[model samples]
Structures are given as structure tokens and as C-alpha cells.
Target: MVTLNLVIPCFNEQEVLPETTRRLLTLLDGLVANGAVDASSGIMYVDDGSHDCTWALIEAFHSRDPRVHGIKLSRNHGHQNALLAGLLSVEGDVLISLDADLQDDLAAIPRMMAEFRNGAEIVFGVRHRRDSDSFFKRVSARSYYRLLRRFGVNVLQDHADFRLMSRRVIEELRGFREVNLFLRGIVPLLGFRTAIVKYDRHARFAGESKYPLVKMIMLASDGVASFSTKPLQWSAYVGGVLALASLSFGIWALSIRLLTDRTVPGWASTVIPMYFLGGLQLLFLGVIGGYIAKIYAETKQRPRFIIERTL
Candidate 1:
């Protein structure tokens, strides 16, 4: 049996940590008993600078069970960075990442391990169904995946961070030192022997979702900006098209004023084009600005996350 380290990223998840811990411990015990993983297999929870008693609870868990370990970050570096911190700072034959919210089904862990043992470098936990999500969420998520594909970015549609990575795969991942962390897009780029285990997603067990509407939008934007430059290309294409249209319109207006007496004396044509083209230019600038911001962040070479303490 090989050693497995389960990493979970937590942020203000005090309400759900106890239940999440209980379920994970039970699942780990079963895997060990079945000889799927060694007894040394343990769960590591990374506290993403929670404001409440999350770190305190994690410390208690660690004291209660040697199998339960914790890593406290110096500040809230977001979920991806915290997950990266746990993955990079652990000792095990294989590493698995999951969410602290219990929505990522724990039952899939064993299957992922099975695939890993079968010589797969990475085993992705893909969601079979999103019945638990709201209508808007389902629609938006579907659209997001489709948009990524349209942008020529390779990413598993229903997969988040629930995945198992072999030691070598994790080692390769460490070589990627980008500050704009987007693991979902980054993992697929690491080509290797891979497998997928499908499972149904569940609703949050407790507390409000850490990723509300604003955060979800920001994450989607980051995913796109980090992976593909298609947005920039498309914006340029749009500008070219609008420029040609503006030139044609100018020629037509000149013809009407010089060759004929058919000209409208109103702000409809002038103000309309001004607002429309102005809005398009601003939109293009925003897209370009987003990429520039990511470049700026990466160029700084700042630490993705800082560890406050560990147990």
C-alpha cells in the first residue's frame, strides 16, 4: 500500500470542518482497511487565514489524531494558492486535493486512488451531475466551460480541484511558478497518464458558500485570462471590424453631404456612433487591462502563499 496525503483548503469553514473531518477520517480508515492505502495515510487541512475559530478547530483535530495535520497560512491567499501550498508542502507517495465544504464527494477519493495505483499520473474527479446546483449556477457553469473551450483552453468541464496527483506529477507542478494561480487550467497542460472518476456533486453541508457571485465571476475571469490570449485577439478583431465600418460610414456621409441634399440634422447618427464605439473601445481596453494586470502580478515574483505554522 502506498502513502496518501489528502489536502483540503479551508477558508471560514468552521461550521463544516467537523463534519468534513469526520467523513474524511472515516473514508481514510476504510481505504486503509481495504489495503488500498497505507496506514500512514493522513489528512492535511490548510487554513486560508480564517477570521473565526477555524485554525483553533484544526489545531484541536491535530492534537486529537496524529493522522490529522494542519497548515495555517499567514493570510488569505485565496483557494488555489492555499491548495497549492498544501500540495507543495507534504510528504506522501500520492497527493489528493479536496474542498473543505463537503460538496466535493469524499467517496470518489478511493476510486481516484485506485486509478492512481493503476499507473495513472493524475486522476481527475469529474462531476457526473450538477443536480444540487441552482438553475442559474448550472447555466453559468455550462457556459463557462463552453467559453473556455471556445478560447482553445483545455480544461475538464466538471472538474474542480478534486484530483489525485502522483509524486512525480506534483514534482513537475512545482516547476510552474506563475503567480496568477489557476490549477484547473494548469493541470491539464501537464500531459501524462491520466484517468477520470465521475461522481455526483453535493450541496454545501453548512455555512454560506465561500465563493459567492462576485468571487465566482472573478474566478472565471482569472481562469480565462491565465489560460488563453483569445480574448485579446478577439478584441483586436472587433476593433478592426469597427474601424472598417467607421470608414465606410464616413464615406457614405460625405457622399450624402456633397452629392445630394439628403442629410439628417439630429444627434442620432453622431451620438449613437460615439456611444457605441466608445463603449466598444472601453470594453477592449478592459480585456487588455486584465491580461496586463496578470502579467504585472507574475512579474513581481511574489510568494503565492505564506505559511504561518504547521502541525
Candidate 2:
């Protein structure tokens, strides 16, 4: 039987850690008992510089059960980096990543393992439905995935970071050294034989969501900018279209002055086009600037995360 490791990233998850620990250990026990995974299988928790007793609770779990492991980052490096840290650090034949909250159903674990045994190297735990989410969240999330697809990002819809990767897949993933990580996009690019196990998402067991609206927007921006230059290309296309429109307007104005009896209002015509073109210029510049910022970040080659301690 292959050793299975669950890599969960935590930030201020003190409220849910106890129950999360209990449920996961029980699940692992069941897997081991059924011979689905080796008895040596375990869980690794990455503490993303949470200020609460999150690390201490992890230590407590580790003391009580050798199956529990912990990796504390030097600082909060966001969820994607923290998850990456755990995946790279853990030792197992297969690795499954999920959130600290119980939102990602544990029930899908066995189904994913079955898929893996059936020759799937990457088993994505896709949400079957988002009935637990608010209406705005459901709409926005659907739109976000659709937007990524439009920008040519090959991502599995309703699949977040909750998925299984074989050792070879994780090893290949390590070769990707970009500092601005959007794993949701990067994983799909790995081109492995993949499978999907659908499960209903539950509400957060406890604590506030780590991803607020602002962070979600930033993640979407990163997903778009990292995978495709479509935004930058669109900016150029817009500029070209505007230029043609401006030339056509100039010709129309000149013709009115020369051949037509109707007089064009000089200030209104000039100022309106000027304002419109100016706004478009600023908008495209902002898009270009976003790409430049990503370039600047990638050049520094800073370590994505630092492990302050591990247990």
C-alpha cells in the first residue's frame, strides 16, 4: 500500500484544529485499516505565521499522535505558498492538499485514492455543488473560473487546491520556480493523467475565511497575468482600434469644415474624444504596469517560503 500524506495549510485555525485533527486522524485510521494506504500515512499541517495558538495546537496534536506533523513558516506567505511548502516538505508516495476548514469534504479522500490506484496521477477534488456558499460568492466564483478559461488558463472548474498528486507529479511541480505562484493554473499545465472526484462543499467549520474579496481579486489577477499575456495583447488591440476611430473622426471633422454646411462644435468634439482617449490610455497603461510588476517580482528570486520550525 502507498503511503498517503494530507497537506493542510492553516492560518488562525485554532477554533477548528481540534475537530479537524480528530476527523482526519479517524479517516487515516480507516484508510489504513482498509489497506487503502499504509499504516505509516500521516497529516502535515503548515502554520502560516498565525498569531493565535495555532502552532501550539499543532504541537499538541503531534505530541498526542505521531501521525500528526507540523511546519511553521517564518511569516504568513499567503495560502498558495503555504500549501506549496507543505507539499514540497512532506514525504509520501501520494500527497493530497486541502483547506484547514472542513469545507473540503473528507469523504472525497477515499474516492480520490481509488482514482489514483486506477492509474490517475492527479486526482482533483472538484466541488460537485456550491450550495453552501452565498449567492454572490457562488456567482463570482463561477464567473472567475469562466474568466480564467477565456484568458486561456486551463483550470478545472470548481477545483481549488484540494487535490492529489503523485510523488513524480510533485517532483515535476518543484521544477516550476516562479515566485508569483497561482497553483490552480500551474498544476493543470503539468499535463498529467488526471481524474476528478466530485463532492459537496460544506460551510467553514470555524473562523473567518482567509480569502476575502480583495485577496480573491488579487489571486484572479495573478492567475490571468501569470498564465497568458492576453490582457497586454488586448490593451494593444484597444489602442489600435482607438487610433483608427480617432483618424476616422479627424477625417469626418475636416470634411464637415471643407464640404458640409453643418459646422462641428469645435470644443465639444475635441474635448470629448480627448477625454475618452486619455481614459483608455490610462487603463491600458495600468494593465501593462501589472505585467511589469510581476516581472519585477520574478527577477528577485526570493525564497517562496521559510520554515521556521517543523515537527
RMSD, candidate 1, Å? 1.0
Put down candidate 1 lDDT per residue, 219-278, tens digits, no spaces. 999999998999999999999999999999999999999999899689899999999999
Candidate 1 collision pairs: none
Clashing residue pairs in all predictions, respectively, total 0, 0
Regions of candidate 1 where Cα sits further than 4 Å from its true position = none
User: Mind giving the per-residue lDDT tens digits that candidate 2 earns over 21-107?
Assistant: 999999999999999999999999999999999999999999999999999999999999999999999999999999999999999
Count steric clashes of candidate 1: 0
- Model 2 lDDT, residue 244, Cα: 98
Error of 2 at 131 (Å): 1.7
RMSD in Å for model 2: 0.9
